[model samples]
Target: MNFFEQQDRARRNSGRLLILMVLAVLSLITLTSLALGVVWQLFGQSHSSLWLASDGAIGLLPSWRLVGVVSLAVIAVVLLGSVYKSLQLSRGGQAVAERLGGRLINLAPQSLEEQRLLNVVEEMALASGTPVPPVYVLDDAGINAFAAGLTPQDAVIGITRGAISLLSREELQGVIAHEFSHIFHGDMRLNTRLVAVLHGILLLGLIGGFLLRGSSRASSRSSRNNSAAAIIAVGGTLWLLGYAGTFFGSLIKAAVSRQREFLADASAVQFTRNPQGIAGALQKIGGNLYGSQLRAGHAAEFSHMYFAAGISRALDGMLATHPPLDERIRRVTPEWDGRYPHVASLSLVPADASADQRAVAQGWDQALAAGFSPASATAAIASIGEPSAAHLQQAHQLLDELHPALRQAAHHGSGAQALLYGLLLAPVAGLREQQMQLLQPLLNADLMSHLQALEQPLRQLPGNQRLTLLDLAMPALKQLGTEQAATLCAVMARLIRADGKVELLEWTLLRIVERNLAPSRRLSGHFHLLELADEVQVLLSFLARAGSILPEQAQAALAQAAVELPYTGLNLLPAAQCDLKALEAALKRLNQLQPLQKPRLLKAMARCIEHDGRIEVAEAELLRAVADLLDCPLPPLLNTTSAAQVG
Candidate 1:
């Protein structure tokens, strides 16, 4: 599905959920209120009251006042507690996104292209007018990445070490762009909501634990009376209910999370205007050693959001949070071969290559960063395009022309050096000597020294830049294609083979290199708010110039889509814009248009009418005029209808 359809669906879903939450709270309150009333009646209507009630002076007792006060206190507590919990859940969502982003920012994959991941994310955010999101690194030796957040202002883009090392710039752009699609079109909000809803469900379990513990302590302090026994029994029941809530909450999280992933993948391709990059990335995942299994502790909770499954060993149809890896590959590759090559058999690089070879690898990396084909250079410049400053703003045009080549290069270039070098050189270098001393007992004397030599320069470089160096060094081993990439990956496996061997940071960096060089991998990129709107404007401008509809009619129709209002507002020339004559001709021509061509045409027209913040009354009238002529109802496009219509 396209972004607009996904966005509309998400918004509708959110509204429905909010309504449900309100109903749930209200129902709870109503039930509680009624129970309180019943309990008061049972206690307040005592024998003394019955005896006095027959008198003319008989009236409601003051006992009801005590019950009323208690009822008000209960209501206040529930409302206040629920509100506080909601806010806490929101903060936790932000925390998850930020924590992940911080790790990615540390990846600094030494390659010029790979280093751009951070910059690209920032650019997208600025373009979209949202705050720049945090970035995180997944230290998996697999080609994958993902974006997660509750909103544009609080989102994160995470990449596997494999992705930074394996995919070229274009492919990386495709991946990042895919994530941005989730960010811009309201998918992030849904993700955040899932986190919150799940948290709310699990809250009971946490409370149950607290209650059970508290009751045990209380029982120790109190006499073994019937009251204590009853309290403990109630606590035990609440604990069981809490666990039940946790089970349902997990299911809910998995269910809602899976569908949006498919939509985000489609959107990523749309945003980058390239299927190959993401498709390539998926292919690498299936072919790689570690695949996409993330080693991070939090992998389970974030599985559904990963570009590929984080910890899954094999794809299971129902349990899967992502589409089957093979299916995902097929969607982009349009080719099928289930076999994947092993990483060790592919390359000739010795885990213990000589000093000279290591230096050569470094040189290759810097050259790759600097090197560029004329065609790609031309493509990058052309991607920017001629700004229609006279017709469209420069900011808008800039947003329209996102290039894939730059994305690929950035993911694998030398420029990434500066970013990584700044973050990790110290901790890594400090540990190197200590590691070397320990490894002396296990390895051949020469192998230990060779590794030690690689460490100093490697440590001298920053995290991202060092990562680029590894990418540069690894290509010699990867050029055998699949086998070579695999072989080089094995060298990485061997290097970390010893006890007290690889530090977390070291392993993370190595995995990053492995993923970058993976044979089947593609890349990804994304756009921000300014970019989205600018592109929308370009589409509208193009449609306004298309024939069959007058500029005014085109403009009106476009405005309807943008405002998400009924077409009745854009008072069109009833017979021309919407009548059978108008539609038949357009539909006939539309069939001749390529996939997405018609949507672009429609979106472009929408742009013209949406120049103002609100849809004009005249625009609404024009739309109705067109709809009436066509004998079509101008209805608010619901989620069910939106998919069919947009598709």
Candidate 2:
């Protein structure tokens, strides 16, 4: 499936999960109620004879009121538990990684392994046109990794120490590609939701355990043996029922997770275009003693999120989160010959030593001269979730072209803060002075000094490079304290306003940073394309005007876009009505468009910008900004002279 299909499928899977979870809960309630009724008949029916005497049908059944209350209680507990866990995880991917004993990998690498991992992740991000997500290291001797987060902005990649130390560079890339598949296919959000919902179902088991423990302690002290027996019976019953619920809940989780793993494995091969890389990793896992088993205690909770299962299982093997190891390897590498490679510890070899420096430099030079074409635009959009070898080459060359100082600045939190400030600084003398004056009071002297030092380098940066730097700095910027982040947002807005007009690049930078760093303020609404026509028109007009230098040009661009619309008579909104504020509001609503609707909207946008038969730097930046708002990562539109860009 393509990117849009994957998104739509993930949404449908979420609905399927809900239906299954409800059924599990209902089953638990029924079993628990029946158990309660049996207990009542055995103990509470004092006046009637013991063995089904005068009590008749009434004795065998639970009270309707009791059943109602129990059902309500079960529903409330499950919903509340799910919501609480979801909220906790909503703090972002970092929370989930840390909860599972992952240590954040510093951007400034202290070790060769760290540097190699960062480079791989950066290349993948650039290739796929995504912000570079933070990487975390789990201190475990296991070959596994996972992606986590509610959205791309907060997404994080996690790897175990064993995977880094044991796997070859190619093998590691394959594994990272697998996790990226999860990020690109919208699996991370669903994986997190599964974690939350399972927590809710498991809460019943936890409560039962607590009740049994409390009753056992009370029984030890009580002289009223009969009352003590009753408590123990009730506790045991609840415990049994809770465990029974968890059994089926896990089945549901296993069923949903298993199929996705196979698809991700296939996508990994497709993404890297190297089946042997992934197939080799699996073979090593089969041969190695650890075989992807994590040492972290919480590994079991996120088993499905991993590149491979993080914990060992026995009977649960039937409900495993990943397919059997041999089966996976065979699928990826059909000529496996039924033999696993001898796993051995890896030497500390430099990962990219074999990379061709000359070829990489040439790639960048060629990409610079290549202008955007309609075909290139389409390929760039389609390549959202699927990065190819060319994209990888471009990403590599792009990294090489970036100034070392600017690149290094993107790795650290303090430096990243200064980098952001540098991007927002105005070129005009008056506006620059105004912005500096406003910033001096709000920020400390050290940060201001850093920003001033980086100003020249940042100014020399190209439009595309500036965006890549912003993408690189996202993880570090997200590390800022809440107050600091809020201050940064306010200061950025102030600086933008200080210029007396909103430049497209300035506004794009602000939107990208805030969307990634600040808490998500996604406008929630149902997808209704017809209802959103005016908002769509406003946005298209903004794009049309932003791309053209003259009123007639803008009108011409608008006309091109109108051809793609389902209805006629859509005209360009007035320039006054297409300001940044209006554009922002329009985007918030447009963002709620259905996954299928997004392609049409994006196609219209492409028509609007390419109407003059060229895409300028400013127009490309605006396109990237809109894509970012829609949670889509558009690759840099290479300057191609003609179409046939896709291989």
Candidate 3:
């Protein structure tokens, strides 16, 4: 499936998951009512019998009032647990990785293996035009990996130490590509929801376990045998019920996760176009002693999120989050032999990163030499969330071509702040000096020094690479603490307003940065094209003006783009109506577009840009920036002219 189809499917699956969870909850309530009723009848109230159907008899079924009270209690606990997890994860993918015993890979990694891994991830992100996600290392023997987050901006890739040490660079790329597929397919958001939903279901068992332990302690602490016996009975029943509820939850996870793994494996091959790369990784997993089994305490909680099954048990056939090892290999490599590669130990011969990394610069230069044809709107939209080998190669080239200092700066918090500051420094001497004077007191000495150091390089940086630099700095920028991030946002605003006007390119960059720094939690919404009239007008009109210089030209461009909008009576709004502030506000709402609706809207925007038949590199960047804010990751396949000519 393409990006749009996969997203739409994920949206539908979320609904299905909710329905299934509700069914499971209902089953638990019934089972709990019966079990609790028996407990009440057996010990607390001996007068009642064990059946509700007995004619005019007080059976095991408790009074409706008692059952209602118990049911409400269960619901309250479940909701509380679910909400707690949801809020915790709202802190984004980093929270999940940390919870799973993952240590974030420092931007300036010391080890060769870490550097290589970072390079691969950076190339992939650059190729896909996504922010380079922070990578985390789980100090586990398992050869497993996962992509976690509610959105791309906050997404992170996590890998076990074994995978990093055991797999070859190509094989690791295959594995990373598979996880990236999960991010692209909208699976990460679903996975986050699943974690929250299942946490609620499993909380009952945690409570039951706690109660059982408490009763045991009471039996020893106090010589009250009858009270202790009653406690044991209640605790044991709840424990048993909780186990049953967990089984239901596992089945739910298996149902939602199994098929997605297959799709991701397929997508990995599509991404690298290297079947053996992924197949080798799978074979190694099948033969390894630890395989993909994790030692993390919460491994079972995130079982469905792993690149492979992290917890293997007797009921694996029914509860397995991933497919059978041999089965996955066969799908990836149809002619695979029955015997798996025996990976008792890894031949991890360390190599210097500078000497071992691919010739990405050469390859990227080759691609540029060959020339890339500009894509139509449909083709550009299709490339969203789908990065090919060419895109990967180009990403490597782009990163390789970038200045080392600028790149190093992109990888750390202070350096990233300096890089952004340098980008916003006015081109004119007077404006540049004015902005500097304004920033002098606001920024720290260290930050000012970094900005001064990067000034010359930043000014000479290609316009195309400007946005790339911003995206590359995202993970580092995200490292800032709350107040620091707020201050950073304020400084960004001051720099933009230093000249008392907002340029199109600068405004777009500011929006992209701000949105990524504080992403929207919305996955999909019910807002249709017809319902979002004002938003549609603002966004389209803004694009129309950005791509057309004159009033008449903007009108004509707006009309050309309006064909793609599913609404009637759409017209070009006056410049005041679609000012930058209005455009930003409109984008915040358009972000809620349904998965299917986004493509049409993006295509319409593309139509407006190409209405003049050729796109300036700056205009193309603006189109991409707008699309990025809408949560549609547009690829870098537009014009390559060097200057920053927006219109």
Q: Pick the candidate with the highest lDDT.
A: 3
What are the per-model numbers of colliding residue pairs? 99, 5, 4
- The TM-score between candidate 2 and the true structure equals 0.93
- Measured with C-alpha atoms, the lDDT of residue 357 in candidate 3 is 57
lDDT of 1: 0.45
lDDT string, candidate 2, 343-433, tens digits: 7654432334233223222222213333466556667787777767667667776788887777878888878999988898887778777
Model 3, which residues run further than 4 Å from truth? 44-59, 221-224, 344-377, 638-647
- Where model 2 places Cα greater than 4 Å from the true spot, the runs are 45-59, 346-370, 429-434, 521-525, 639-647
Ranking by TM-score: 3, 2, 1
User: Ten residues in a row with the worst lDDT in model 3?
Assistant: 363-372
User: 1-647 in candidate 1: lDDT tens per residue?
Assistant: 44334445666777776565555434433433444344344443332222255555644332445445544654454445456545653532345644443353422444443445654554343322233345676555666676665544335677876776666555676677677766656666666565555455445446557767877788788776545555555445445554554454455555666776766667556545567777766766676767777776766656667777776633255456677777776776676576554443113212221211211122222111222222221121111111111111212222222222212222332222222222232345455345455445644554444444444444333222332233222322222355644544464454454344434344444444443343111111122223234333333333333322465656654555455322223332333344333443443333233222323433333344444433333333232222212211122111222223323
What is the alpha-carbon RMSD of candidate 1 to the true structure?
A: 20.1
Question: Which whole-number lDDT from 0 to 100 does residue 192 have in model 1?
Answer: 58
